[model samples]
Target: MHKKTMTFRCLLLAALLCPLASVAQQAPATADIRDLASSPRWLTTKVYIEGAPQTDVKANYPGVVGISTWDPERNRYEFFYTDTGKSKYDNGGGGYFFITGDHKTHVLVPDVGPTKTMVRRLETLNQCEFTYSREVPRDMVENNPLVRIHVVHAPYTGTVETLSALKPGTPATP
Candidate 1:
């Protein structure tokens, strides 16, 4: 009968389209940095030392770097730098570094999951005249205080002697 044929055709079409709909629904809604660069909303800002001329250094997602100012009032490290670089939809994670007069440490905060790692490759970029350091809050570095430095985009990096070591803020003796 024509009615039977019509019903069968309609059912077949629905079955074929169902999988396509599901696949499209499963695709991630958010875009990556490469995609963001193409959008008109994408904006980048540079951070500068109070007295030094701004440098080419930039703070991209998962790449925030700065120095830890001693907060006498709070008795804690006050991070003074630029933005956190998180997306509007989700809070993108990053790393941090703590640079003291003698040493540097690295910390990684992942966007997802429960694991945190610390790194120790605190090398100075002599050519760029920049130093790097890192630290993890006591809560993050509890069980495993030692962070592995095998990956890129760790959470934090710090430097000694403030931004003065790099330029106009102060004379670079070293």
Candidate 2:
């Protein structure tokens, strides 16, 4: 494996496995934007679009998108990905995203069965900066290799962006 690819995977593994508990042994105090226990909740300041999705979902998921509120109680957030063309994807249009974990890390796992969704990972540094990424070999429908990555800063209000900044350097699947 190439060094860059390995490094990226290590980083992702860390993000995916970050602990969500405040009870863990304290070392340094870093802010966890995913921690929605506070009031007002986390809001999307901007969304970024990088590469492209499956041809079928391409029309719906855009380069830049807006995000909805993060509901802690429901552990879910919502967003719509539509191109200016204003066309709809053949799948299920856009569906809701369910995120798991807390504080240290928050991730959108792969969907089982029929949804055919991708795994999205989000790491919000502050109200202004955050990273959202998706690396699925075949998105929405099978055989569509889609990888999206968005490293957003102020003016940061968002959702799905295809592989630009964060896509894996190597093949995601063996």
Model 2 lDDT tens row, 2-115: 434544564466555554334432222354544433423223333334443222343343433432333445443333332222212223223223343343434432212233
Candidates in order, TM-scores: namely 0.21, 0.37
lDDT of 1 by residue, 1-174 (tens): 643454355445444543443422121322121221122121223322212334433432223443222222222122223343222111222222222222222222222223332233333322122223233322233565532211112223322222211223322211
Note the Cα lDDT for every prediction shown. Answer: 0.28, 0.37
The most accurate candidate by lDDT is: 2
- What residue runs in model 2 are displaced by over 4 Å at the alpha carbon? 1-64, 80-105, 109-118, 136-148, 151-174
Task: Provide the lowest-lDDT 10-residue window in model 1.
Answer: 35-44
What is the overall TM-score of model 2 with all chains considered together? Answer: 0.37
The window of 10 residues in a row where model 2 has the poorest summed lDDT is: 165-174
By TM-score, the best candidate is 2
